[model samples]
Target: MALITRLSTQSESFNSALRTLLAFDASQDESIERATADILKNVQQHGDSAVLDYTQRFDRVSAPSVAALEIERREWLAALDQLPSGQRQALETAAERVRVYHDHQRAQTWTYTEADGTVLGQKVTPLDRVGLYVPGGKAAYPSSVLMNAVPAKVAGVPEVIMVTPTPDGVRNPMVLAAAAIGGVDRVWGIGGAQAVGALAYGTQTLSPVDKIVGPGNAYVAAAKRRVFGTVGIDMIAGPSEILIICDGATPADWIAMDLFSQAEHDEMAQAILLCPSASYLDEVEAAIARLLPTMPRADIIRASLAGRGALILVQDLDEACEIANNIAPEHLEISTENPQQWADKIRHAGAIFLGRYSSESLGDYCAGPNHVLPTSRTARFSSPLGVYDFQKRSSLIHVSQAGAQTLGRVAATLAYGEGLQAHAASAEYRLNLSN
Candidate 1:
C-alpha cells in the first residue's frame, strides 16, 4: 500500500482530481428521500407508535413507552462513579473547557433607541428543549456529547435529551457517563433516521424538540434534511476531511501518519497536503509507503489517499491557503515554521490545528472545540455546531406614536417600491392615525 497521488503547482488539475473521490452518492436519492418523508409523516401522525415500530425495526430495541426514553439519574450516577478517576477527571476537564468556550459564545441581548423614540433590539433566547444525536454503531463520542450538551446548557436551554443507537439494545456506559458530566437531561436508546424522526416530531414517550444537533451516517443526514423545515438542524455533514499545510518542518513519517488519521475514517474521507517543497513530498510518500502497510485499515486508507487525497506543491504560502479555502476542508492543519501566519490567511475551514503539536485528534476529543464541522465546502457558509445552535433569536421593536409617525412614511415608500400596496397602506394608515 502506498500514497499514489501527487500534483505540482505547475501541473495540478483540481477538476480531474475532484471527480474521482465522489463516493457514496450523497445519501439522497428518490428512495431515501421518499422513505425519510414517509417516516417523518408517520412519526408526526402516529407519534409514539410509529417511533416504537421504527426503533424495533432499525435499532432492535423495544422502546414502547415514554418511560423507556428517560435514563434515570440513578443510572447516570452509577455509570459516572464506576469510571476510574482518570477517566472521570478527563470528562470533567472536557466539560469545563466546553462550558467555558460556549459561555464566551453566549450572546448578549441588545437594544437601540432611535431619535424619534423608536426602540429596536435583538433578543436571544435559548430553546426550551433540544435533542442531540450521538453516533453509536461504530464508536461512541463522549466528546460529541460534551460539545452538543454543554452548548445548550450554556445557552440556558431547560432540557437536553440525547439519543444514540443501541443496536444491541444497550447504550454504552461511557456515553451515559459523559452525558452525566455534560448535564444531558435524558438519554434514549434509539438510532438511525427513526431516532431523528422521534426527536423532530415527538413520540408518545418523547416530546418534540425545538432543535436537533449532532452527526450521524448518511441515513441520519437525509432524515435531518427531510425534517429541517419542522425543526432546526445544525448542518448536513459528509465524510471527514483534513488538509495539512506543511513546508516539511515535520518528519515525512509524521505527515504521512496524519494523512492516514482522517483517511481511515471512511473510504471517501480526504487527506490532502499542500506544500512548497518537492523533496518533502517525496519523503512523505516514502513514509506513507512504509507506514500504511502496517495499519489494519490499510486498504481503506490507500483507496482514500489514491482517490480523494493528494500532495500538492504550491508556489508559496498564500497560494496554499487559497487552495485550502477553495477546498474548505473540515480540518485544516498548519505544520509550518510560523503556522499562525498561514492560519490567518485561511478564509474558510471547519476547524484549524495551529501547529504540528496540535493534532486534529486533540480537537476531536479534548481540545475544547466542537468536532462536528462543516463538510464538503459548506464551511464557506456553515459552522461547527455550538451554543448558538440550541438558541433562537427574535427581533424586538417598540415604537411610540411619534416614532411610528416619523418612520411610517419611509416604510410606506419602501413597501410601495416593492409593489406591496397592502403593506404600504397599512403603514400609511398607521401614520394617518398617529397624525
Candidate 2:
C-alpha cells in the first residue's frame, strides 16, 4: 500500500526523488551481443536448422520448418471467423480504431521548390518489409498485433511479417485473428532471439525485414540492440511503468487498482503516485490493502509495489509537475481538478492521461494510442511506437543553376575548410558549370 502526501520540498529534493524513481540502467546482465552474435551466426550458417534448435531449446517445442513456417491467408481468415462474434467484433473495432488513428500519422511524399528553383523536401517511403515480434509467454495479446501491424499497414509497408513464440507448437487463434484484422501478410510460429535473427538475416523460410518493431522480454530487447545495425529497431524497451499525480479527490481503490495493473506486468515494473494531500495518500493505502488481495497475480503486484513503487507527497502542484517531468514516466495520469493546467507543466512523459476518467488501462487496451511506449525515463528522448516506425525518410534536393551558383561557393569553402578536396572540387565544378 502506498501512502500519499502533499508536503513542501526543495526543487533539488524533488528532482532527486524523480531521478531515483525513473532511473533505469540500460546496461544489465546477459551479454546480448554475445547471445545475439552467437544466435545470428547459427541462423546465418544453418538458417532454419538453428531456428528450430532454439525454438526447441527455449520454447520447448519443435518449430515448423521453412516449408511450414508461414500461416496461409485462408487459415488466418478462418481463425477470425471461428472467433466468437463478440470477440471478433472487438478485434475489428480495435483494429479499425488503430487504423484510423495511425492513418493520420502517415507521412506523405512532399517536394517544395523555392523561387530560386532550389527544390528541398522530404520523401517518405514505407519499408519494403517489416517484422513484428509478439510475446506468447503470457496470454496472447491480439492488441499487440493491432498496435504493431496496423501502423505499418497505415504506413503502406508492402509486407508486414509477424513472429510469435508457440510453446505448444500451436498458434493462438486469437493471434491469427488479430493478424487478419491488421492485414499482416504472414505469421510465423517462431519467437525469441531466433525470430529476430530470422527477420534480420533472412532464413530459408522468412524473408529479411528492413525493420522490426514490437515489445518483448529482456532477451528480445538485447537481441534487437545486438542486431541494430543489421536491421532497424523501435527502442530498447524497459519494464512497464505508471505514475499518477493526484489531488486526492479520486477514490483510493481506483488509484490502487491502477497501480496494481502496471505492477503485475513484471517484478521490475514500477507504479508510483504523487499526491499533494496526506488524507488522499492514507485513503489510497487503505484502498490498496483492500484491493490487492482480490487480484489473481497479487504476489507479483505486491513485490513490484514493495520494491519499485512508491508514494510521494509533494508540497504543491508545481512540485508535483516538476517531479513528474523529471521522472519522465511511461504512463502519467493527472488526476487533479485542473489536470490540463497541471499537464502543461509536465515536460517529459511518454503518454499523459488527463483527468480522473482517463485511466491508463484504456490506453493499454482500447484507446487508439499505441501502448508501446518509451520506458525507464527514455521518454526524455524517444516516443511511443507508431506509423513513423515503419517509414523511412529521404531528403530530396534539386538545385537549379542559379541556386547552385548561389550555394556552391559556400559549400566549396566549407568542404575546403574540412580538408576534403574531392568535396570542394565537386561543388566548385557545379559552380563553374553554372558560370
Identify the candidate with maximal TM-score: 2
- Give one digit per residue, the lDDT tens place, for model 1 in 65-106: 846756687887899999999999999998898788778888
- Weakest 10 consecutive residues of candidate 2 by summed lDDT: 1-10
TM-score of each: 0.92, 0.93
Off by over 4 Å in 2: 1-26, 31-34, 432-435
Note the Cα lDDT for every prediction shown. 0.85, 0.85
Task: For residues 71-154, write the lDDT of model 2, one tens digit per residue.
Answer: 688988999999999999998998888888888898899998899989999999999999999888556889999999999999
Q: What's the CA RMSD of model 1 in angstroms?
A: 2.4
lDDT for position 156 in model 2: 90
